[model samples]
Target chain A: MEKLNKDVWVFVEQRDGKPADVSFELLSKGRKLAKNLNGNLKSVVIGHDVLALAEETFRFGAVEAIVVDHKELGHYRTMPYSRIINQLIEKEKPRVMLFGATIIGRDLAPRVASYTKSGLTADCTDLQVSDVQYLRKDYKDLLLQIRPAFGGNIIATIISPDVQTQMATVREGVMRMEPLEKHVKGKIRNIEYTPDPVDELVKLIEQHRQENKVNLKAAPIIVAGGYGMRTKANFELIRELADLLGGEVAGTRAAVDAGFINHDRQVGQTGVTVRPKLYIACAISGAIQHRAGMQEANKIIAINSDPEAPIFGVAHYGIVGDAIEIIPRFINVFKQKLR
Target chain B: MQRCVQTGALNQSIILRIKKAAMGFNSIVMVKQVPDTANISGQVMKEDGTVNRAKLPAIFNHEDRVAIELALQIKDKFGGKVTAITMGPPRASDILRECLYMGADEAYLISDRKFAGADTLATSYVLSEAIKKIGGYDFVFAGRQAIDGDTAQVGPQTAEKLHIPQITYSEEILGIKDGSVQIKRKIDGGFEVLESKLPLLVTVIKDAVSPRPFKARRVMAYKNARTLLELEKLTEGNSLLYIDQLKDDYVNKGLYIHTLTMDDLKLDESRCGVHGSPTKVHKVESVVLAGGSHEMIEPTKEGISRLIDQLLEDHILG
Candidate 1:
């Protein structure tokens, strides 16, 4: 039997021609999984003038880069873009493909998986090799991927019973990005496919371009606010704290509800998932929904009034206080040290 | 930022004010009330380690209702209607009633035992099938993820099942133009704004739209909205019950559920239930860790050395 493409491939998600940080993060994890499985890490790029991006992918830890450049592919449309990925999967048949569980990953992964009839685990908080392979005598491409369950309080490891090319769409920060210091040896493999000729399943009715995320997921430090901040003006406190530490400020669903932060910055089950070196939860009660989004951070520092707030359950260190009072002092301490 | 996305024709009265006042848009919302997820613990799970759902309290999933709220906001501004739909056990009617109370003009519950244990794929099939039956919808909105399963599949999967485009992790519906909706997608680092046409589906984040309070008047009016089964319980005597009498009574009162079963959809039996599902639970292993007594390792090298030496003695060291 012919072995399907046994290489590891990753999707380099970009916005308005700018690449997302999770792409590098995915590559970092990809390097490990590939090496573990005796495969290679290949990153796929689909955008215009992405030759520079191809070079950058290597810096981000992509061992090999695949570029599919087209003017129609310049803007994101579900149909044309999904077709591009489906074609790529068919030609390359990478054994394991990773995508950032960002907006695009949320949309495109299912479409691609359904198109290819493969299994996909979405918004996975944990990823690792499964141990069941030791029981199998013949199977060679078995993978044991792990993820958080029970809304992130427990870890559940899973595997595809019998599917080729086991796929997982990972949360942005769930994996860490390797530093771009020593350039790793890699190659750029070019495969061309027509962007047109596919039946248009949907039409682009109108477009209002917005700025894209640069490093929100891979940010070294993150300052996240919750309903504790109360009003929209209060969220500025979180932003100021983040600015002092050269970090990005995120919000919980409640903070967004209070009109403190926009929906994009939300960090919870339904919001963007991130794993940073340090996660500071301010006044966040740590609802299972919110915690499911970011419990995977390497170190968690929770600041809340309720000593028993669920956020403390996952925090490496905790402070029982008000967001209004504690955040200002914390910022002062941060400024004194880092400034 | 909380723009409603919709597809399909609506009563022009809904759009007239939007065209005139330049406010509100058409929207469709998906809602589900799941057992409160926070209520599980040791033996709160059963002896078998399965969830004791009967003891679990239910709440309108905070996110899915917010998706409905966003849709309702679109209806408020763009001058349209909000239709709320839920698929779950028959008891899910509890949330459909809440949807009705929350200002959705019409509501539906698609309940069938055959739909049980549906992974995201099977659930999407049934939702898409129901959508086809309901007909005439612009945009479909679902919570970014469901609390019970948290697969985040049904929304995007349903869109795929319908062969419509979907934008997930939608933080905000920025605007709608030429029947297409533009949205700010919450990506890993920042936001990506993508535009796709009407009839698109979007899975909304929890705060995408804060839901409005249930209206007093609508709550009172639809309070008696009964399903066919409930109606049967009420009129057990009529027509013995008279089939005609029961039908007329249900029609007049508008208390009908338009109940659908596996047979009505012409579904294959092999693909409907446990047999239809491909995923199997080989075994569920629950590990309970007991917090043990603390053993202190002293600061001094000798004490620490003794601690490590003891660790090896106790077989605690690899």
Candidate 2:
């Protein structure tokens, strides 16, 4: 039997030039997984002239970088991107691979997984390297993919024990991003992109990208609402409070689905993970999926009518009352104090 | 690949067809009936680490209905046929009928006990097989991900099995000109306009387009459409209505939802179901948010004022 490689590889997703925050977050998490498996942490950077970004991975504890720089690979085209990653995965045979569950990552990872015939899981919240016994078969050094399933009602630990290569797409903000204090010199392996005729099946004609106006991550305070806001009209109280307090307004997935907020303002496992200095959750039940994104805030205050709302578990201060009624009073108090 | 220079804006139905290599498009939309994950109860999961779907009510995945809407739009624009298919239990036929009500020209149910317990990979293999059996399709469509699994793997995986290019996260179909289809797809903080050759697969996002409401007339037409398995169940222990005769009658009226099984698709037994799934659920833990110490505040104005004061004292607010 061929020996399984223990190297942990993170697909460094980038657009234009700057790499995604989730890619760096995965690199930081991959560092620990690689250490547990007794191997090196490698970053696969693919984009036009993205060679410079390879060094950035080292700051996040990557020991090696595999750069596939090509003009065709500048923006993420599914065929070419997946083709390049599949070739590298087939050649390197890394034990574990991680992708940030961004649009580009979700688009590229599954195709590569199909081409490589490896087991791939999506939107994983946590990943760990552990030994596992499955179906009466002992497996050593497997990647345990932990994720919230069934709308975050349950947490399932999934493992690809039989497959040599285990891949997972992790949502952003689920993992802590910690750069190493000590920098290690990393090796750069540049792989040539051999374009194929099939790669031209899809051609990018035009692209329209606007700078995201909502910077929830950088905000010091976030006032988020949930389904309990009742109606789109009632959801305005959350926005009004946020406006009065000079903070950003966010929402749970339900609120987004209910059209109370934009997808960009959504906060949860499937949306952006934010660590504001203060998080004020209003009318949000605080499901584990939603908590996975905001529980890391410096201070949490939950306002819910349900006394047993799960959001209270993580809140520093729990207010069991109607947000619609309490928010106006809270606003009046703040207005008087600030005045 | 077909390429033709655009002639100044002319009637698309007449002039565009004259320049195009292919006259019409045939699309297959994949639909799924998933458990309502939002209304989950404590009994949602069984003891074996799998979801007790029987305990939960099933509904057509919202995004999938959006996919069907996109396909139906293509059919209306380009003079094509839309076929909706699902791989699930017999009860999944409900969604297929719903597909017909939404303007699908035909519907298929790919169900078998042998296909049970399949993960994304195994499920995609079976779907790919069924797609091949229903060949001559220019486009394959599905939702980005089903709410129940939220894996979003089956669309791309099935596309790979069909050996075609895919455009996931599609927002709208720009146009199909000179035998190539233009699509506007969503990316991080932006959108891209891409053109792909025929026989492509696209997975749609919820924001793509509002699914058309089921037409009342179409609903009246297809409300009684039943699959062969459904007919078998209806005729079970009823001597008068022979299953075969009833199926033929339904097929003649075009009210029979085509049903395919493992034997019909000739799928490899090993790769059809749970055996083909490489990923296994090792453990399922009910979400128990770790209890932490917290202060309960009164809902009165005085209590709110006191909380505000504490925030200022802690420098969380000023």
Candidate 3:
């Protein structure tokens, strides 16, 4: 029955001194939640010499920033990161914490939740705070966490009614970052913490950064393929069309399974969710799994041999044909016109 | 704590033999049966955003199958047993039988009418209790998330309830050495390799490995595996067949899937199902993006030219 602090906190995820855009997005959303709750919006940044990044959180909407600076925290080792974040939560007792649903966030949030014995909702698409009656008792200021379930067929809202601190990890690109307010200023609090020796059980060996890869989430235009591409070599057609259209190339899960493309390029419920302005599907059967990721695209065009392909169900434009034959002609015309 | 013994300068196979003799890692895979969302129809979605699961056909969750496959692979290499357990209605026994066909050493179905309407929190509590009851496991495996709930919280929450370390989005088991395991996990841009000690939980992603198809002979052998509830339905009102006798017969044949109720596990009724879950659905809206106003073009050269022209006009191409 301990009283928890009344503040909204956002975990600022950064790597190599660059703050992720999702951090800003969370700040924008967290600011609104803090305003509703009549509390201060705070940001927590953990890294080596990350004070500047903590200061940057204010431009996004944070009223105050907490910086935990340590060399061991630089590279996102789970144990140290979770240990520090959990310690901070235990000491500060923030009512609600928001994290970006990135890889590091997914790993760190659950571990911290476990350490603190709190509730966490992951990959949330939307979040809000409201009062509600549960078990015939009124609970005020509960975090309403909403996310697509059943493979995006349904959206479910979840809340932790009893837990002192409610936590959620929102997926990237699902929320828009607020425009920077250069005039806004925030105070920064620097804290020093040492990592436990056990936290070093998992040692960092080497990090190989992926180069020359298309990030489907940020792409405004995406040209994706499916099993209809026929072979791994035929994926070149998808790449060619993408290149001509100045878009990124993506694929269905089947295409990734067949080794037509790397798993990174796979788009679906299990892969990256994208909201491009233009999503062009070639020979994609458009299973619900695939559609869940791209249905949010502004404009969709489907070209396939089967007019009955599910991809056309959500398409803004439909062309029934063989992609092998149709793509070459389309690519040639676009190349000529753009050139 | 069990300290790993290092046999330096010993013969390699002998070292492996000693390790295997000293540590036989048993695994428990948490499985679920989810409604197939790929082929959802109008009837499958109720007016509330919640799914009318009764109207939809349920199948074994895709990632859970992969988790079982990973468990089986670990058992194949490390010399241990794989036990699959699911908490759902009696019909969830279908997936347990499928697990048997895929080479699980034992299958368990945790069912009770009181367990209905459980959210991830309640669901994980029950699953954690079941795992504790079926003790002596060094590893617990589960899919990254069930397609139906898609919360991806149960596995990690269960790990927390059990006070065990967990690895999520695991892609591969690099190796097992010195009472620890090295796992390659998928991340946003790439993958990271991390090592954790024994008695850890791992949530496997669908991209981890392609699950092997059910063996034909094993499928035939386990196709009739039934839970206790299923057995009761069969023996009810039959003068000649008694429930206990029929259960013994199936048990003797190695075709009886073990069943557990809330009382069997001594779980608190308040924390077993809907009563324990804190999440409340505020509203449900069926999201149907408008379509059908698209231009349908022919597959000819002129058609291709027109499509390109339209794309340029719309500025989607430029």
TM-score of the first chain alone, every candidate: 0.77, 0.96, 0.84
Supply the global lDDT for candidate 3.
0.83
The residue pairs found clashing in candidate 3 are: B49-B284
Docking class of 2: medium
lDDT of 3 at B239: 80
lDDT of 2 by residue, B33-54 (tens): 9999999776776665457878
Q: Model 1 segments beyond 4 Å from truth?
A: A1-5, A58-64, A90-92, A131-141, A179-187, A195-339, B1-29, B38-51, B66-83, B103-106, B149-151, B167-198, B205-212, B228-239, B242-248, B269-318
Decreasing lDDT order of the candidates = 2, 3, 1
TM-score for each candidate, following the candidate numbering:
0.73, 0.95, 0.84
> What are the runs in model 2 whose C-alpha is more than 4 Å off?
B1-23, B42-51
Question: Tens-digit lDDT track for model 3 on A1-339?
Answer: 765577999999987677887889899999889988878899999998898899888887787888888887887777677778888989888889999887778777766776675767777777888887765889888888876666566666777887778899986666777856473688989878875775755666545445426578889999999999998888899999898788999999889878898877888755678989899999997766688788889989899998867688889889999998899988787777766
What docking tier does model 1 reach? Answer: incorrect
Interface C-alpha RMSD after superposing true interface residues, each candidate, one decimal:
8.5, 1.5, 3.6
Error of 1 at A249 (Å): 6.7
In model 1 chain B, where is the ten-residue run with the lowest total lDDT?
Answer: B288-297
Q: For candidate 3, give the lDDT of residue B23.
A: 58
